[model samples]
Target: MPIKLADIAIFIITLAIIVFYSVTTLQKDSNSSYAKIEIDGNTFIYPLEKDLIKTFHGPIGDTTIEIKNGKISITESDCKNKICIKMGKIDKLGQAVACLPNKLLITIEGESNDEVDILSY
Candidate 1:
């Protein structure tokens, strides 16, 4: 059996569509990772999409963490420097805010949900 020019063109178009679909699907990343707060070695996890405020007891005193509009930040900190609050808001995965004096570490934690898990340097 012999294939015509039109048939070959159709096959190439179909191949291109499949390749595009696969690449796009594999490249998709779920950016809904939760915000994690650590105080005195204790970890607390909250969804970044949820808006709320939480008070955590740190070394100095209570540290207030607020999540609004998919962003997380320290609104109040009892630590002398208040550096944690100064760190500002973060919603992306792997971002963090820390107050050493208060033993606090706030981070965005979750798998990237991408095509590859391990990257070699």
Candidate 2:
């Protein structure tokens, strides 16, 4: 079958969308960054520039996180599947890794600002 006008239009639209998303995702901020760790009801924030290792307790067991070279990763965990540890490292803003069984979440975030967003409400 021959290509139709609609097919070309759709291809162009899809290519444009892919290009737009790629450009936006590649932009990185220069602001200071941190890793926000949350387990149960407690929250902890640590600077990404600092290298450290910390373990937190959850309902199941302990989850250890490590920060090195401005990136963070789940270095150890008691969760059976260990998918969290396999998640590797994250250093970009808004990247996250979670261990659902341990009720743990680690998110990469930038410096806080005075402006409020929808989540703050």
Candidate 3:
């Protein structure tokens, strides 16, 4: 049996799509592990070294933060506008989670023991 040119083209296109999807999915999964969450003056460190999901609730515009499957994101909120939810997921140290309506800010800080000294003249 002989393969038609159109059939070959279709097969190539399908393979390309599959490869693209697989690469994208893998990238997203790998990136999830580095997720972190910060709220108010306190920062929650999610090792993500193991599979874990954590949920946090605060008075920040009535918002809830959810960290699951190595990804940290805003799960729910009672604010009139869900702007924080649209901020999407954060997976880096020093990243922040904020709810403007409730005046809540969360920032991820590094675990370094270094101290800062200020000298006044």
Candidate 4:
């Protein structure tokens, strides 16, 4: 059997892509951290304090926002565009739940108080 140059190129490209994706995925997973949610000056420590999940909802230019679990996600909305729903679930620290039209912002705070030196700037 003879191997073509094109075949060798394709194999090399595929291997490079696989290696890149694997490294990126591992980095993301390893950096993930647990967080507590804070919305509108109220802290939602339900997941830590009560072992329960709570949901938040509001109008965002006709879209509704919903957050639950240890994560924030959009459950229902009326927006002509469903971009919020596509944003998916967020459970890590510094993650956010935002509804642009409704002026709602939910931020996740990590359990750790240690700060990265570069972040101080």
Candidate 5:
């Protein structure tokens, strides 16, 4: 079998794409951020810098969220699986924990004015 230049180019392109995605996914924002909670269709936004506890009631029951030391986590939930609670804490922008049965989602969001310098990517 003979190696072809076209095959080498395709492999290089694929490797570049994989590296790009991996770098983007592994990077976490260090700037100040916020936490967003979505229940049903309504969304509640909170600053991640604040320390507070919130409980949201849904058709199933209550879901407890706690934000402390710039980290947010689902401390309690009435859902049967308890997967949301197992998601642990999230402090970086774009991290999320969701409860499908209760239609609840908690996501980390950063300020829009945050500069996207070379280091950010």
Candidate 6:
């Protein structure tokens, strides 16, 4: 079958729309100033400006997190798959890494703001 001009125009428009939305949804690293660690319902806040290493104890085992040069990463974990550690560093606002097996969650957040955007049932 031969392609028509209408189909080419539609394809270009769709590709442009996808790129625009994806680029607009990205969070800039400059707005990310700190990291929030939530472990077993306990919350710990740390600044990204400083370099430090901390370990949290979870139901499964210990999980080690590191913050250096304005980025945070899961350096070590006792989780079976170690998927969290493999996720690497994140320095953008709203970026997160989760060790589900260890019940640990780390998210890069901006300055003080207390607003719930979404809730799960």
Top model by lDDT, which number? 2
Clashing pairs in 1: none
Instruction: Select the stronger candidate by lDDT from 2 and 5.
Output: 2
Per-residue lDDT of candidate 5, residues 45-93 (tens digit): 9988899999999779999999999899999999999999999999866
Better model by TM-score: candidate 2 vs candidate 6: 2
**How do the residues 37-120 of candidate 3 rate in per-residue lDDT, one tens digit apiece?**
445556555554445544455564456666655446676777768787888766555566666764555443434312211111
Model 1 — which ten-residue stretch has the worst lDDT? 112-121
- The lowest-lDDT stretch of 10 consecutive residues in candidate 6 is 112-121
Give the TM-score comparing model 5 with the true structure, all chains together: 0.67
- Model 6, 78-110: lDDT tens digits are 989999999999877677899999999998777
**TM-score for all models, in order of appearance:** 0.67, 0.67, 0.45, 0.43, 0.67, 0.66
lDDT of 1 by residue, 1-121 (tens): 6999999999999999999999978864466588888777677889887899988887679888899999999899888887778899987667788878888888887656342223211
Candidate 6 global TM-score: 0.66
For residues 34-65, what per-residue lDDT tens digits would candidate 2 score against the true structure? Answer: 88999999999999999999999999999999
How does model 4 score by TM-score?
Answer: 0.43
Which scores higher on lDDT, 1 or 3?
Answer: 1
With a 3 Å backbone cut-off (N, CA, C), the pairs that clash in candidate 3 are: none
Tell me the RMSD of model 3 versus the true structure.
Answer: 12.5
Error of 4 at 32 (Å): 13
Error of 5 at 8 (Å): 66
Model 4 Cα lDDT, one tens digit per residue, 5-118:
999999999999999999987653433344344445555443322223345544544434444544566655555566667777766556666655544555555544346322
**For each candidate, what is the lDDT?**
0.80, 0.87, 0.58, 0.55, 0.86, 0.85
